[model samples]
Each structure stands twice: as structure tokens, then as C-alpha cells.
Target: MNKASRSTVYDGEVTWQRIADEVGLSRQGAKHVYNKAILKLQKNEQLKQYWVDLIIEGRATKCD
Candidate 1:
């Protein structure tokens, strides 16, 4: 998803095909993985907050 967000291939958006190729999975498999990750993040509040905190820390460090 990060790669997709940063990609510029499809009019500034990356395709599932690109993600699949990078990860050695079929396009459908890549989509499945992405969906599964989203579900996990949604269902696990602690895990989600951990990542949110990490992102905030990363931004703070980057700014310094």
C-alpha cells in the first residue's frame, strides 16, 4: 500500500499488478493480502495504535 501510495505508474497511482510483481504474488493474491491487512488493523486496536504512534514518532524525528 505504501508503494501504491507513492507510485506514479497509473496517472500517479500504482496498480495491483505492480504490487503483485514486487511481492511475487498474483494480482488477486496481492489484493487479498492488502484486504487482510486492513481487516487486521481494524480489528486490533492496540496494533493500530502502535503503528499510529510509530508514524507520529517518525514524523517528529523527520522534522527534527
Candidate 2:
């Protein structure tokens, strides 16, 4: 994930509005971009696994 996508995940559990605020986008726009990125990642097993590894290594910090 990119900076914007990471920010979305960080704030989505609380409120996507927070993500929008952080990323300078509207709430709905943030949702759209986040959903699209997730779908893309899901469709690529290798990329998904890479993301999982990064998460496990604690290197997935809001866009590392």
C-alpha cells in the first residue's frame, strides 16, 4: 500500500473521516481509493503476501 492507503487502514477502524483528514481527501474519496487498492492487492497473491510479510515485520507503518 502507498501512503494514502496506509493512512486509510490506520483510520478506517476508527473513522474514514480521519483518514480523509490526514490525506487531504473527502471521506468518500478515501474510501474509493482504499477499496480499489485492496481489490488490486487481493487479486495479486504475491503482492498480498508481500504486504503480509511487511506487516509481520512491523515495517508497514503508514507508508514505510
Query: Which candidate number has the best lDDT?
Result: 1
Q: Give the backbone clash total of model 2.
A: 0
Cα miss at 19, model 2 (Å)? Answer: 0.3
lDDT of 2 by residue, 26-45 (tens): 99999999999999899999
Which portions of model 2 show Cα errors greater than 4 Å?
1-12, 59-64
Task: Encode model 1's per-residue lDDT on 1-64: one tens digit a residue.
Answer: 4576455444345889988877789999999999998889889999899879998997797789
State each model's CA lDDT, in order: 0.82, 0.79
